[model samples]
Target: MAEGLRTAYQLEEDDIATILPEEEDKFNGEEFNKQFLQFDRDRIQKINQKGKEKFEQGYSKAKKEVLDQLETEARERFGVEDDELRGIDLIDHIVEINSKKSKADPTKLTEEQIKSHPSVIKLLNEKEKSFKTREEELKTEYDTKLNNFQKERTFSAVEKKALAIFDKMNPVLSSDPERAANQKSILINDLKGLDYQEDGDTYIPLQEGKRLEDPHGNGVSFEKLVQSRAARYFDFKKAEERDTPPAGGGDGGATGFPKTEAEYAKIVNDQNIPLEERLEIKKKWNEAKSQS
Candidate 1:
């Protein structure tokens, strides 16, 4: 019976072997598992190293390209040489002098010693003076250019408002040649309302005075309305005079008459002016035309 049992077990082993390859002689299951884990860790480390190397290479290339482009642009746009653009070499000289001083005996730094190191002192002084000179030059250039730009293109809101008021008064004033001529000085005097005491050039509207409460209850100056009207008239007259060039280069010139009586009638009909003043201006205009 024991012999029969051994034969049956051997036959079963043979059948299993025939169905599958024999277990690998070198396969220690636990050792193989540990080896697989170490293989994975090594692969991960290699991948990280490659990634870091690529990142470093890209960064270095970008930095070099950017620096080269900046240098090229500076040279092209500003005519700055590489040496000049690198900044003054005085700093290197200063560092050298400071280093030497650090090594020298502090107690022995006499006037003679300082004078002997004249090159360092001269370089320091030259650097300071050159910096100051360059700063002053830049400031002056900026101010000059800014002023020219302002003069050519800038206008304050007050100036624009004043000009608009002047335009509105133009036709009325131009209608009466005699009144425009005779009262021109008075009209100029009336412009005092437009003149703010601040910078003395700006003109705010007369309505702005309503905002201020006077302690004496004096209220808004009644003169403001008269002044504004007169100022507008005067500005128009001045513009017209400028447009009408002097004949024969002298103050005495022919007064150009209005083309028609209807033109003068328009000023006589404007409602903004006092009825009495409008009528008076019209009468004077008629008299001037009759004399002409």
Candidate 2:
């Protein structure tokens, strides 16, 4: 033995047994290779099987979803509600119905068949309700307008005739352009106060809801009636005074107060004299005449 090295003779039995192996205990290369190869094969097989199962499951689910989508689209396009018919059979039924509709003549359909159609019924209902109502409204509107227009025309014709009569009643209006319109307006208002209204092309004067008549029981012309009432309304000249002196010309003298009937006429008829001053002269002349 080398120095400091323990020999077999000097070591304990337990220590020697611990360091050495028995003859029956040893490694085997062939058995290890067989077990490792089997383990690898089993693992690979399990992974492949699991992948196949996942693929099958996914394929079936996707296929079912596609089929369901196709059925929904087909039903909407063909407006089909037959739950029993599906896929190609449903498509064929939709095509056959379309073909029948295309081949049928719309004009040959009976009234009941036409009424049963949804779109046709909807259109007919709308027209029946709206067209008649709209036509009535338009007719009423047209009638009202026509009535108003006729009334306006009659009124205008009567006014024109009345104005012509009034012009004859006050001939001075033709010469006095400035006061003619105002005076005519006043006269027309007075005529209206006598219950004047238009009857066709003529003017009617009503008294107590009856047409005014002359003593002869004849219908009194508006001209004659207005002429009879003219004196009460105004002291206007029916015709220019025969050779009367011009206004403000020695008619009233220095005081401008008329002393005689002729002087009063000249003063009142004078357009040159202001209306207020003429009215005042008339009032004073009347007072003086009453006292006399």
Pick by lDDT: which candidate is best?
Answer: 2
TM-score of each: 0.26, 0.34
Q: Which pairs, if any, clash in model 1?
A: none
Could you tell me the lDDT of residue 46 within candidate 2?
69
Instruction: For residue 287, give model 2's deviation from the true position in Å.
Output: 46
Clashes of each: 0, 0
Write candidate 1's Cα lDDT for 1-292 as tens digits. Answer: 1232235222244433433233333334476446544543564476557755765565555555544554454345434444454322433333345546579654456556554565545544654565556556655655675555343222233333443444355433544545644554454344433333223444323334443224665533423443445555444344545323234421211132234677445645544344444545555565766887
Q: lDDT for model 2, on a 0 to 1 scale?
A: 0.56
Judged by whole-model lDDT over C-alpha atoms, candidate 1 comes out at 0.44
lDDT of 2 by residue, 1-292 (tens): 1111124123344433433323212323365346434544564476557755765565555555555655665677668788778755664565556547789654465656645656445444654555456556655655676566455545444555776676544444544645766766766666655555676656787777788888889887777777766556566552335244337543432235665799678767775444445666666676767887
What is the clash tally of candidate 1?
0
RMSD for all candidates, in order, please: 39.4, 52.7
Window of ten residues with lowest summed lDDT in model 1: 249-258
